[model samples]
Target: MKNKSGGHRRSKSARNEAAAGNKNGRRRRNKSARHGATADDGDRLSKLPNDLLLNILERVDTLDAIRTCILSKQMLNLPTMLSQFFLSAGSIPGHHDKACLFSCSEVFRTNNAVARVTDNILCTRNPKIAITKLKIRFILMPHDSLTIAKSVARAMATQKVGAAEFEIRTEKDYEDCSPADLLQFAKQLNNFVGACWDTFAGLTRLWLCNMRFGELDIPNILSTCKLLESLHLTNCDSGTDSVLQVKHAQLVELQVDYGEFDRIELTCLPKLQRVIYNYWCTYEDPLYFGFVPQLSKLNLTKTGIRSEKILELSQLLANVPSLSDLHLDFESEKIWVIPECPKLLTPVLSKLQHVNLENLPEGCDLAWTMFFLEAAPFLKELCITVWDHWCIMATDPEFRKKYGFCQKADVNWKPHVPDFKHKNLVKLTINGFQPDDGFMEYIRNILEHAVNITEISLYDRKVCGSCGELAPEIKDKVCPSRYPQTDEERKQITEGLGLASRAMVHFRS
Candidate 1:
């Protein structure tokens, strides 16, 4: 407690030293204040509770959450304390180019910054690290192979694994997997959760991209995931003859993209609601496909099925009393099969609120409309994508003869509104619009008949930029006034805007 100078004898020099000390202290204080004001300020953050901060972090991606650590010392530990594990490699900061790097490449690099952070989280303690959702995206790079495999394994081990969505895309030259590699992949599913045991028992939803499994291997995977609710498989290397026997009663939605199926059987799936099958142009099938009682919607697009079989299948669907929405597309050139068309198969569908048909021959208008007249009595909406050139031909008798041979002047071919009065029909859409005399006559008849029709859409063919610039010429060709009387009525008819408004309409198909 003794002073450096004699207590009573302190001189001016001592006072000067005291003043310098005060100045030095103030300088240090101001320097800290300046730096803390911008980068190290923690006063405002103290307002939020730990729980509230965690909530905010949960909504963002893991990369952004980790960046919060730079905020202050308090935040440094908060990122690691998080219970929900998020493993998205693409969205990390400072790597904007790699943000959407999942597509268009084959070797993912694992030595990146995001992977290091992920490894830390995987290896950390704090047993609260429960992963509810796992999303992995890769470009199929060789360097990323080990990283992806390891990350996936870690996620499966620590997480509850509510959903595991894998998106793997490779270049066109990528070879299909050998049978041994696929089997090994399947076997690893068991190690994810020992109880799963090659069965995704806990997985309610599964999505795979660019995967390949043999014909015999598919059923094995399906049987394991008994509770699967949604299954989507796209561009898999599996052969078309692969028999997919899915009998899960809990499966509600199934979508197969461009696949070959030797035989697809569904013995039981009482809860199944929707199925979409997209086939390549080379596929040929007269085989019968079955469905569950609860099935409601079915879409068959671009399949190389014979036209006759399409009619048979349509008739077959009448048996599914609960079915409400059906979409069937056929190649324009295929000959249509006219089986003994059954009376609208189900009274439930007879009361159908909406119906949609596309790509059928314009000359087969009677056959096309007749199906609607019989099947959808309560139809409230109708859409037709007519090929204008055919619809515009001047009374082609041969055309009518070829399509059931009904004469244009024949009573049976007359446009009858009463037959499909459908008092409920409120909206009509006709795409691929062209204003030829024949088309004008058809429009006049449709407008006059569909009294309840409130709105009709008229859209031209989708043209490229060059063609779009030539739209004036194209319009002149299609809209020329061959018959002034008919053209005037058609124009006046659409004045209500209910006849020619350009709006996209969607109906049950």
Candidate 2:
């Protein structure tokens, strides 16, 4: 939610585009250095057999690969015989990346080029050579999409394609696009999907960006995509506070980023394994799980001010009993999740093995996190990081008050089981560790609770250059952190934890 990558990793098309951008005249010199000093280094590299050259070509942008093949007569048939193609309209020369960054004409021209090149390859490729992968990232332009979608549908019909994917992007980013622009983009996308339903049916992954789609538009698209295993919706929403009810059988993963829905109700996804929801606009609980039998991983990230009701995991994840991995990121905002009693949470979090709590506000109590230990009986690792992220934090007093920011204070929590001896907790990691009396006592308290713990790692506060230095007024409000560095200090800290436990405590600098 707070600036995390929705795309799991950089796609092949993005990597290829970056490589194509940096492939200058220095390539031959580097090639010569690698294959021994020789003047025929470039030729030697290019003259390799088709199989070896094709391997290198496939690693680069499809346009550059085509150009490389066009430069050599012997490699003319390689483009036609290639098994993979990743074409991105945004990567076109002087298109979205160059001086005409926001020019609509440039966008249209680049999309046309992408559609043309995609058609030339998919429509003319050899039938004997099966396409192992086909990916296209193009703008949602009407004419260009029609051409690209029809070519893709034809390729899917004529060629045996594996892992077919589409990453649809609007000409303008979500921040820059207006309401009319978003509506138009969604209309164009609907037309494209309806026009090329066959192409979308073969897609294994689809990422949509920047659209205010109709309430039913999303469900209709999902119905057409029978084989889609993953779907990502970024900055996409319907009207005011619409309830998003999803029921896809084959979807294995789902990501919703900054969506403006009141709540997402997972009706029936029997095969879903992972879900990531971030920065929802609604004040209610973000999700309700209904029938996700195989789901094991859930990551919920949000930045909330005060007045947002405490999120109760017991009710939200009541139906998702199979969850084994849980992560909650607060984005340095107010504590949102209430420390529910163990009896209520343990039912849904029974299989949970790992829990990561990130960006807990500095100076607040760590005692609230022990609720997880009391609840998830099978949990093995508990990791939490405390920091004051100034990048997202407003320093002005008026601005902070207007947004209803909570003052830095401890979260009032009392452990339900004061004498709880957890046997399954094997490790505990705390970042932003301090050597103060309260912090050290907190460590002692943890050692007393998790008697079976094997390791306790204490790390210094992570540096955030992007956050810069906090304002002078705000800096004084944060808790002073002085980690034990010298031997004497370490000895005193260890001695302070006398008779707590035998865990190997490491003071990681």
RMSD of each: 13.7, 10.7
Which candidate should be chosen as best, given lDDT against the real structure?
Answer: 2
For model 1, the superposed segments whose C-alpha errors exceed 4 Å read 1-107, 110-132, 138-161, 168-199, 237-240, 280-291, 303-311, 315-319, 328-370, 383-418, 435-452, 458-509
Tens-place lDDT digits, model 1, residues 1-509: 34767456557776786667877757877888877765545465644788888788767776677777566677777776675545454522222342445542222332244456566665663546565655544433344434545655565666545555444333222134455544444344323323433325545666554445666455666676666788776654355466667677688988776644654566567788887766532333422346587887776655222322334445445445576666654333332333233243435465455555554443444233444544565667766654423222323456544544322221133323344454556776665555454455655555555567666565554333333344353446443322223545445545533444423222111
lDDT by residue (tens digit), candidate 2, 30-141: 7868877776444565678889988998888798898888887788888998888888775432123434454567666777888999988887888889888888888877
lDDT (Cα) of model 1: 0.52
| Backbone clashes under 3 angstroms, per model | 11, 0
Query: Model 2 has how many clashing residue pairs?
Result: 0
The CA lDDT at 113 in model 2 is: 87
Compared with the true structure, all predictions reach lDDT values of 0.52, 0.83
- Distance (Å) between predicted and true CA of 447, model 1? 5.1
